[model samples]
Target: MGSLGSRVLRRKAGLPRGEAAAAGKGGKRKRGGAEGTGDSDSDGEAEREERLLHLRGRRKKLKSTSKYIYQTLFLNGENSDIKICALGEEWNLHKIYLCQSGYFSSMFSGSWKESSMNVIELEIPDQNIDVEALQVAFGSLYRDDVLINPSRVVALLAAACMLQLDGLIQQCGETMKETITAQTVCAYYNSAGTYGLDSVKKKCLEWLLNNLMTHQSVGLFKELSINLMKQLISSSNLFVLQVEMDVYTALKKWMFLQLVPSWNGSFKQVLTEADAWFAERRREFGGDISFLESAQGSAFLPVFAHLRLQYIISDLASARIVERDALLPSEWLSSVYKQQWFAMLRAEQDNDTGPQEINKEELEGNSMRCGRKLAKDGDYCWRWTGFNFGLDLLVTYTNRYIIFKRNTLNQPCSGSVSLQPRRSIAFRLRLASFDCSGKMICSRTTGYQILTLEKDQEQIVMNLDSRLLTFPLYICCNFLYTSPEKRADSEAQLDHLES
Candidate 1:
């Protein structure tokens, strides 16, 4: 039977019977289970390849469909469901894409009258919101990348906020943060405040506080609104090495800039020129300075109310106030003097105790007894006095040591001052006097002690033999509290010094 089957198979293959029989025997030997398994594995691999190709084709088709829809609706505006008019320009946009925002969704999807309208008019009142910003905001709805710069960011943010586009608002904030600098921070901060961007507002304010002197040097303070100025000056967190007088000086400069329309260039030059003009006019007018006084008084009324007058420790700064007749009215200055006298009496009564807290109402009432403007306990306090005569003092009490720092800037006189911590939580001071041009003439470190807390009250008497003093003499002081452990350390250091 095997022979017969071989003959039939050979005939079917159309080969010589002997050759076909030999081939069949060889094939049968090779196909012993393993050959069958090899054929089955190849078939499975082919099937998987075919399935993968099918999936790839489907994905391509889906991607092509999405691309076509975006191109037609957003780019070409070919089946746009709505038109938007902004700043005298028209934009054809799709309702579906616009509906992604709650603002637009509510406008177009509900039974409101706008839903039936084909064109929507955006009537945002901000003059800063222009056509370019609107284009960027509208493009952002369909695309991921939008160009933003300092000049356009304010407008873009305003538009985005009006549209209620959270994504775009966040993007604007991030861009502002990246681009913020001393020169541009004021504008950005104002824009953020206008649009209610709290995060951006906080960041800009912190930067301003940290780099206040830098900003002042660049005349950025001239751009600040009264409210913004008040906010900054009144913040307890503002850290500056400058005396409160420097702050007052900066404020005066800002006010001067606002008053004088043609003023330009260096503040010193403008001030010098103005002083000459004032001097010439004073002579011509027989020293009647009432007009100049009235102008300054009106301009400074809003600003002066925010000044922490008690913090001005420099006699030079205070004298400047009287000489120039600047912010502090005579009545106000008199009240301040009276307050100082009372404080001195109180300190004597308390036997020179630690920091004393005065009642705000009582102080205000006493200072301005009749129709007096009330003062709030803001950043202005006796604890921190502005630097005077190129000298500033800082006293910090921690668990460790009572630290004292005396800083001198641009001092014409040259001398070293030694500070020794005493057992009474005070520092015994020694000061040397130098003549103008940095020449040391006299030294006096003995017979003087300053309580770290009330050091602002103690006057440094210069008994220098030099016939001339270049800078007006003033001393400023500040006291800071620290942790309990630091306080203990401070006490121990005091005891060691006494021992």
Candidate 2:
């Protein structure tokens, strides 16, 4: 009886009517044969089968009920039971259709003053909502599906969220996620956060992390907010070009743009202008106050705090730039210099043999960030700069094969090379190719692995399929080239107190 009731309920919902029950009844009778409920069981079975086939074929030919309702009831506003007034626009809507939205459902079903009113004024506090968005939101109540444009999604999302339309909000979120690009990512991220769409926000952040260094632009730098910039700069996942020095350079450029919002200059000219501007500022203040100490630059201190100054000061040229700009306070540079000095002593004297196990926290905070861009399909060999605790690692891309070599000898290199028989390094490698809009088209990653190598030995780290290979590919790497050193008593005490 309960099963039969459920079948009846389904039928009322516009599902296939009694077909399953009729087919089951015919099958049971056929199986019983002599003891069948009816003698024409076989004939009934044949009739039911024919009817089911006819119904299945007619489904494609039938006009969608939602479409009919949307066209006549929504588009034409025929037989509207209610008029919703807001944003200087009036929508002639029906109570039944409006009930699909939770906001309206509660108003009509609950004891609300506006429930009995034929004409209600909607108080829309969100500025993102507009008349067009409201029209789409209301129309969605009369339809089963909505086609959302990426450009219009935020406004529609705002309207849908206000009316508590879950389905429309979800569709808008999906559209935003799918359409994210360099131009739209910041706007989408802000909208997603505003609408409490965490997934879309995450997608935007991932896009930013991947392209922040690899596919940089003046427009993108201008669009990036301080909060977003801090998140990207702090994470080890940042795809830094060349080395951490480039990240610093990018930050310098971004800071300059943030300060001089009206400065319209070429990408090549940004660093020069930034350098000149800061130098001028230093001269203006007679080098008495650091840029970060100044009122205007203090707002940016939080964002700059995330940069791995240890890496920046490790390189002579980058350290010189930091010193020349005086954007950061002397204490910041002194502290980093002291920290790096101690680290160098530990790496040089303590015989740091790279990381043995993957400590995610350590990698996230201290891993060396670097990347390379491949323009064509050919043999390429390159190395990133750092003391690297004598770990002279060379990267090679040849014939769709990527190989990593620990160059102790055989290859003339610039920096110190470790002669250890075997040393381990915790590392992550990511490769991606982007489209013109800076949306990642294809990508691959070797997620956090500890690779041990012998002097002058190589390992085939990754193999690429020629079919999946896209030109202008960006390869990013995070490496922990030295094992953690034991904390001194004073440092441990200081850390404990801070915690």
Per-residue CA lDDT of model 2 for 1-499, tens digit only, reads 9988988897676656656676786667676665654567566667778687758745743456557788899888899999999999888889988988999999999889998999999999999999999988998887777889888999999999999999999999999988988888999999999989999999999999988876677888999999999999999888889888888889989998988989898988998899889988899889898999999899999988888887777677878888888999899989978877776666677676778898999999988888999998889998887677678889999989889999987888777776777888999999999887778889999999999999888999999988997999899998887777666964897899999
Estimate the TM-score for candidate 2: 0.84
Cand. 1 TM to true fold: 0.58
TM per candidate: 0.58, 0.84
Off by over 4 Å in 2: 1-61, 64-67, 489-499
lDDT of 1: 0.54
Model 2 lDDT at residue 66: 58
What's the CA error at residue 55 for candidate 2, in Å? 7.4
